[model samples]
Target: MKNNKIFLIGLLAMVFLTACNEDVLEYKPEGLLSQADVSTTENLEGLVIAAYAGIANDEMVGPITHQWVYGSVRADDAYKGGGGIGDVDVINRYEMYNLTIPDYGDWMTPKTWVNHYKAISRANFALELINEASEADFPKKTLRQAELRFLRAHSHFMLKLLFKKVPYIVETMTAEEKANATNDMTNDELWNMIADDFLFAYNNLPQSQDEVGRADRSAAAAYLAKLRLYQAYEQNDTHQVTSINPARLQEVIDYADDVTGALEPDFGNNFLDGFDNGSESIWAAQFSINDGTLVSRVSFVTGLNSPNSTELYGCCGFHLASQNMVNAFKTDTNGLPLLDTFNDVDIFDSVDGNGKAPLAPGITLDPRIDHTVGIPGRPFKYRNTVNEAGDMIYNFSWARDPGVYGYFGNMKEQQAPDCSCYVKEGPFVGTSKNVDFIRYADVLLWKAEALIQLNQVSQGIAIINRIRDRAANSTNRPINAGATDVYAIGTYPLTLSKEDALKALKFERRLEFAMEGARFFDLVRWGQAAQVLNGYVAVEKTKRDFLANAQFTAGRDEYYPIPQREIDVTGGLYTQNPGY
Candidate 1:
């Protein structure tokens, strides 16, 4: 009996020892990585890569980078143009400026806050890791840190533009410090701090990077110029324009002088699929399709703006160009744009009472109108084709609801369905088209704005004419040019008054970057939002009933509110912006 009991005890001990073996206990979980795992030079490069990855993500919040919904629709350039307001109800409310604190669009506000901070957090982590490693340990330590700082500044700039108040976070902050971070910095301090990161990047980064998408000195210079341009236009707490600093304007020109990229000979070159990351592109987010992945690494941020349920494009149409925007393309007999009188006559006006017919056959229009907008009877860029009777014309039957929204479809943001860059995911069509965050033309325009502000009106006129020359000479006309309507565009007159030059600069920017999302910011910077947007609503309400009673309050509508969720998470460390 004693021997049998001893045998049972020995058997149990053997089982327990096998289960508790070191090999079994110390095994790492599948696909999990630790700090030590990524402590090498190549691995640190990968970490910076991860930080860059944050900007090119699929989240609407993070890089909500595409400004079609927020910039274009909210401004006068576009309509909330999906099936109806209900297609994305939040967008409708945003367009109307009737957003509530707990409205659905407010959800995007918090998400944007979270995403920008998430990107900043990644940058902070990379900086910390880089700090621990020596130059001998990491050969590209300085460049990597510069790149990360540029990214961090980029994220912060986006936040600053969207939300007037944000908590700035950096690597040195302890968890408690981060939790206690507040938004009490003065406007000048905030702009200067953000500019410091770009200045550091501009000093440290190379002229060009071996990797395609990496930040270079030119990119840093361009972004710094943009930052300085915004800084030059100072605003009060109530969002009224207090002053435009002449010193800061000179700074914009100085920084813009550093950008050496040339304008593409053809303006259309900036929009096509194959022309991405061209010489004109100072910095662009990279995308890839057919890189051996099941799904393409493309941005669908503008996917919803594609025409609804058509063979040319497969989904919702959300960024329909406003009739007002379309009319802004109208040119007078001498081939100059109608800066003041464009809105008096709608593009759809016809001899008969009905306004539904195609545009008048011989009416002269700016050539850029063909590239930036899709008219009903004209050729639709690369998608021009022959239908049943074999007459070539791009159809607008795909427009979700032309009665509610105008008939003009956004053209620059989409690609031809037949292009290699095009991809379909369920009902939406996405493309690998790189969004040109900053272009050389942007540098020119920024410099022009600065020059004009400094009373160098004639010099600014030359720059403005330089841009108009490119638009006038652009050769991206329809395949059957003889069959298309009349196209006319010309440069500004050599001599112009200071007032006329500024108006020319403003109108030129509207045309150059129509759907690319610079409209609202321009209006805000020029201290014309109340005058321009209020007048816009007064007229637009007659066209779009949805905008009835839509008001742009001077103090309240300048910036969106700080997210309520962020306030809750920080336990009230952050204060809400005025008027929510």
Candidate 2:
């Protein structure tokens, strides 16, 4: 069955050809229309769907290999799995850190690159076909084009974030165009193209998308803000400390503020299954488990589960939250990261197998700990069940040997248990939950970060406090006030000097966005990757037995070696990042 799935994916690639030689399709059907037949507006929508499909593709945003692996795994939030060749390679070795190239054959690297461009191509094709269709109405055409532009810009932005110098291909370039293509643009030129694409999307897209999954003007604006922020980081890059462009940072402040009004009052609701279209979600990848369609099964791959759940092949447990990540939640007496003492906390105590006092002095921890980590003795959001023996069982654990399992996994956004049955044999599992691409709280935090950087510390605190207020005061049934423990632990008497305020914002972002794939990039942008990662290496060597056996460095290991294969292909046309 696994071979069959791979074959299907291969066949699908042939059906929807891209300018690039590689194919992005993960599955193919037994029968399908020819490429020429699929060139019309109605037919092209399927292709457009295929493009969106890439975001949810296992290699990209989908469950098995979300960008989170690169974003969080390389940072402190997660450790690589413990077994197998690839498993040890990713987790233990520092050399393969940002493994996003075709040569490494990480599956995710090529899939991510191909998927984004595939989606962009579909959007481009959609715009072209719709423009020629006589029956298309002006409003529909305009909206569809706006949606396409947003998607194109979104994909390009993602590529730029990962590979700082990807070729900027706006229109669908032909094979001849590809032959002449070169990584000729300077960093500024590439960023300008990104900015232009996003601005076009912001100007043309609707404030809100009619569909639950499509991008809106606000999403485009948010991307623009992020792009500008990144570009500001690249202004006269000296690597040691690049100054943030004030003009560009101010633009980020304005654009982020424009979307701040769309925030939902309840922060948790923004992640609920039915709330994919909630006020806070500017954009999300849509999935559904109905009709046995494997298209909607991303959650099954990303959700926390044991190694041997029968519903899915024994491919669970990739992104295990680390002890350092868990420690980040503990606050100091002054309500700030116990910066001086965070490393002093004993994280292993939260689990029974490890020794030391429980994170706090109890069998359980503050409620937010319960909400975030799936330590023993804690109930997950949706996995509470009673067995025939009448003992409550939290099904978050792996079904190891079927009847003998009784452990918990992260249950914050669990889909039905049956959702995993869709894969039954392969590394994939089908889940119907919508994956949020952008949420209002994130935008709020981004704005807050920008404001702080711009010297508006008080305003930044107000924005962050708004998010905290919702988590603390939500009247929704069984609100866990302990989630606010961090606020009290870290924010009272918030006395911070300008530099301290910036550092606080960084810590706040780390805590708030843990396990969400934002930490690594955050470290990079702050110019603190070398410091934090080196600290992690030293501490891991002294404290963690498993990591003690590894070797790593700070300056050389900070940026990933541009996949060796990419260098070979570019043949000196592209320069590798320094120290790679």
lDDT of each: 0.76, 0.54
C-alpha positional error of residue 43 in candidate 1 after TM-score superposition, expressed in Å: 0.9
Candidate 2 per-residue lDDT over residues 96-115, each given as its tens digit? 34433334544445445665
Lowest summed lDDT across 10 adjacent residues in model 2 is found at 1-10
Displacement of residue 116 (Cα, Å) in model 2 is 2.9
Give me the candidate number with maximum TM-score.
1
Tell me the lDDT of candidate 1.
0.76
Q: Estimate each model's TM-score.
A: 0.91, 0.80
Give lDDT: candidate 2, residue 286: 59
Report backbone clashes per prediction.
0, 11
